[model samples]
Target: METNTTSFFCLLLLISATVTAFLDIDELRNIKYGIDILNKPVLLSTQGIDKQLSETIDVTSKHGQIYRCIIPSQMEAEKQKEEEEKIAMEAGVPELLKPMESGPCLFKTRDWWSYEFCYGKHVRQFHMEDGRIVGNVIMLGYYESEFDWKNETNMEIKSRNKNRLNRYHSQQYINGSKCDLTGKARRTEVRFLCEEGTGDYIARLDEPETCTYVMTIHTTKICHHPYLKLPSQQKPVSITCNPAVTDQVYQDYLKE
Candidate 1:
């Protein structure tokens, strides 16, 4: 009885060795094997499977192997954003700011008291005070005409003088307050104040009279120029009101 059992055990060990020799170790490692209810080898994961088998299994394939479908996070976000912008534009939503076209353009303030003209990439601003231009006008490319000045009717100039004084107490009063272009007759000059009540006026003609032109304009369209810049705030200077100091010293110091 003992001899028969020993022979049976040796036969079982030989069969096990033969089966191990015949199997490919690398091929077995490449497969994802699992056990089914009947204890049969079943495929679990399809990654690295042959493309033909992957397709049959309804799996994505890449380079003869199965692969997971994926998209870059940033690429997905960019695509979604592009579609949204396209839809918004097609819906007729106007942009808050429109890019300016190249070349000369006019810009004005909301109150229509300020105007800016842009040309050759250069920008200049004109400000009005008390119905007259109080700042530099020559910097704005002002020129005097050689022709005689022709006065326009009050009715014709009324619309142009809106928000400006029309009637003054006397000619002397008007002269005192109105913009004076006398010095501007020959050439353009800066740091000059216009006639007091001439804020609504413009130099329409090169030389309306001997060297002056009665001009008026009103529009807020000039404010949209590309070269327009915000005005800078003026800094206040401290002054020492000394009794011993002469008036000339104060005046000179102020100029400095």
Candidate 2:
């Protein structure tokens, strides 16, 4: 069952097995378009009504770098700025309270990535505090072998039935199928984890194939929002991931 009813969305999502979305202003503030919205043919019939789902996102940019500004809340665009001023003054001009890698901005949207199926759904926290982002967790799911398939040698002539089923028997009735599933019945594992990136840029930003989540989770070079640098002489800027989570997770493949 679908929950969102609006015809418009401000979240980012991709089509197909993939997800895609857009950031209206900064990486923090994005307009996401999900498959469900497009897939839902029912909502398109709305006549002249406007629907919206808004969220607040914290944006970050390099100290001396140039980036676009974002409107915090879609419903009320200026509230964020007003709140920031109040926040800055209350802190007594302290950088800690006003520590910013980039100007604090709000994100407004007619749509949001409410579809839990998409990668943007895991945008746990998006904030720029003190030139860095803290506690941003991006999650992804992938398949792995439960058994150590890589370690297996070859076919095993087990004591079980030895007839290969796919082949036709005398009448092609297919004798009680039997054969060594030498390379079959692998023990596989699926894993999910949160990645905390403190680098400058995310690798494979487009098709982050390694992880299921597409939205970038950045941390400050020190500890805030994700940091990214421009290309150097040879290589482009890159972001490194700090395992917010690392465990045995599950064995990709094992020999049962």
Candidate 3:
């Protein structure tokens, strides 16, 4: 685990909690259990599964504030690592501790769709629905690729260097546990991401001892969802009569 990264995040969380308390919503959504991020709404998660994504990245021999990349002293770096590890292990607690899915699921996608995007630099600062006041989210990790877009258009990603690949890192964030996007305040999530390059790790470095870029993500609801709680699943449909599912057996059944 990147100890400095932990300290950095803890600082961010501390500020967030204070902000949450000050704002004092009716009730914060308790996110529990490892969940289907895209398929399901941000509800809750338990402790992490047996093996999960690494929350740590080797920021460098030195770690710095999330808003800026400043290397810490070696002695300071070591101390920070231990402290960060403690907090990460504690905060890394999965809402639900279970075996993750076998196939690439919610948080996972194909490489063709996931390619190197604008890496290295990102935005912090999230806005409350009322843009007048800023929300507590100090920094957010932003990342985007054609992965989700592939379903929309027929296209492919071409990566010459591995540094442009979105392979290891997963974008995770605690968006406002519940947001009132709809007419009623709805549960919300402020997702964060890290930027990773597909090129050789060594190639990315100007100096071997020092680290390169750290990615921060930003997000906003494009249009108002208007108080509808995100649905966990769509109504079960008759796939057999989907017309698109015209297998021989289905066709025979249709005839019958």
| CA-lDDT, candidates in order | 0.29, 0.24, 0.24
TM-score of every model versus the real structure? 0.16, 0.17, 0.15
Q: Residue 255: error of model 1 in Å?
A: 94
Q: Rank the candidates by TM-score, best first.
A: 2, 1, 3
Best by lDDT: 1
TM-score of 3: 0.15
Expressed as tens digits, the lDDT of each residue in 1-256 for candidate 2 is 1223122222212111211113344422233322211111111112222223332112112232211112223444335545654553343311321232253322212122121111111122234446454453222221221222123343532111133221110000111112234322211111111123433332222223322233232323222111111111221111111111112211212211
Candidate 1 C-alpha lDDT tens digits along 104-170 = 3544553544544332222234567786777764333332221111244656434433423231110
| Candidate 1 weakest ten by summed lDDT | 167-176
The total number of steric clashes, by the backbone 3 Å criterion, in model 1 comes to 21
lDDT per residue as tens, model 3, 136-241: 5433233232122123232232231133322222222222123333322111122222222321211110112111123222211110111111222222111010
Steric overlap count per candidate: 21, 44, 45
